[model samples]
Target: MAKGYKQMLAEADALVVSVTAEEMAGKLEDDSIVLVDIRDPRELEREGMIPGARHAPRGMLEFWIDPESPYHKPWFAEDKIYVFYCASGWRSLLATRVAQEMGLDAQNLRGGFSGWKKDGHPTAVKEKRRT
Candidate 1:
């Protein structure tokens, strides 16, 4: 027998905190909360992201968070609470779980960026990065 994506997602969801768009919006002004967007660049180009959110592609997350890793990002060591979001929350859920296991204060947005936009939340576009 083999486990599937749904089972993995369920397990991650059980362990990760899921915050609603409204809750996240309330925390926007909190200096201790850092909203993280984990979608790929193409997705971001197709859809805007939460304002002031930091972009950390899903692929580089673990490396960026590990202090011992040469790719470690200083922000990962900050005292802020990280709230991750993807297009529809799936990737973010798994990301939250992994981040927590790596000793981060992390949570996933319940409905992700799509839900946030649907709920009329504020969005911002990132400047294109040179390749």
Candidate 2:
């Protein structure tokens, strides 16, 4: 944690808010949390995705979260919980930051997509050959 950021995290009621892939896997059947894939379409096409996770593309996440915006979807509401993941933890961290910034209850999967697979969760493989 960065010096000032750490202090802010403690002062702002913010928590570490992280969960491993295995924990998330067991929670998937629960309706209380929404799993989002923040990876680009190309990545999903190449590596497939987590079953039941929604694709919100990292690029347009904010747009989708804007309640009054034409792109707004039911998933953007702050009352809804979110678990975001990407090929690695970086993008998912960014996504979680965005969701938190928007006042949504969200957390990042520490190891992300790779971690999900490593934890023995079933992955949805797209029917295509990787180049």
Candidate 3:
């Protein structure tokens, strides 16, 4: 039998710390916490994102986090707590585990963007970056 997504998610969840929307809400203004949105661009456009969250598409996350990769994002090298989220937490959970393995202090946003919105937390429209 092959390992499935459920099993993968379970393993990741066990290793990665999860923060509730309410908990993350309180840290919105904390400079040390970096909120990373790991959802796809289409998803974000269809459904706004948490205010102050940086968009880092899930497909390129590993490359972006690798310092040796040309795609590496400078912010990932910063000494900050990374809180990752997706539409419903699944993607972010796996992403967080990988990030932690890469040596960053990463965490998952419990229930992801859905939970945040359900909890009445504020969201902001993502602006298109100018070429």
Provide the overall lDDT of each model, using Cα atoms, as 2-decimal numbers: 0.94, 0.80, 0.95
> Worst lDDT window (10 residues) for model 2?
7-16
What would the per-residue lDDT of candidate 2 be over residues 42-128, giving only the tens digit for each residue? 888888898888889898898898897789877678476798889867777766877788878888888889888877789886555
Can you tell me which runs of candidate 1 are displaced by over 4 Å?
Answer: none
lDDT value, residue 46 of candidate 1: 72
TM values, all candidates: 0.96, 0.80, 0.96
**lDDT per residue as tens, model 1, 1-131:** 89998999999999988999999998898999999999998888778789989999999999999999999999999988999999999999999999999999999999999999999999998667778
TM-score of 1: 0.96
Model 2: colliding residue pairs: none
Instruction: Provide the clash count, candidate 3.
Output: 0
Best by lDDT: 3
lDDT string, candidate 3, 1-131, tens digits: 99999999999988999999999999999999999999988788878999999999999999999999999999999999999999899999999999999999999999999999999999998765556
Better of 1 and 3 by lDDT: 3
Q: How far is candidate 1 from the true structure (C-alpha RMSD, Å)?
A: 0.9
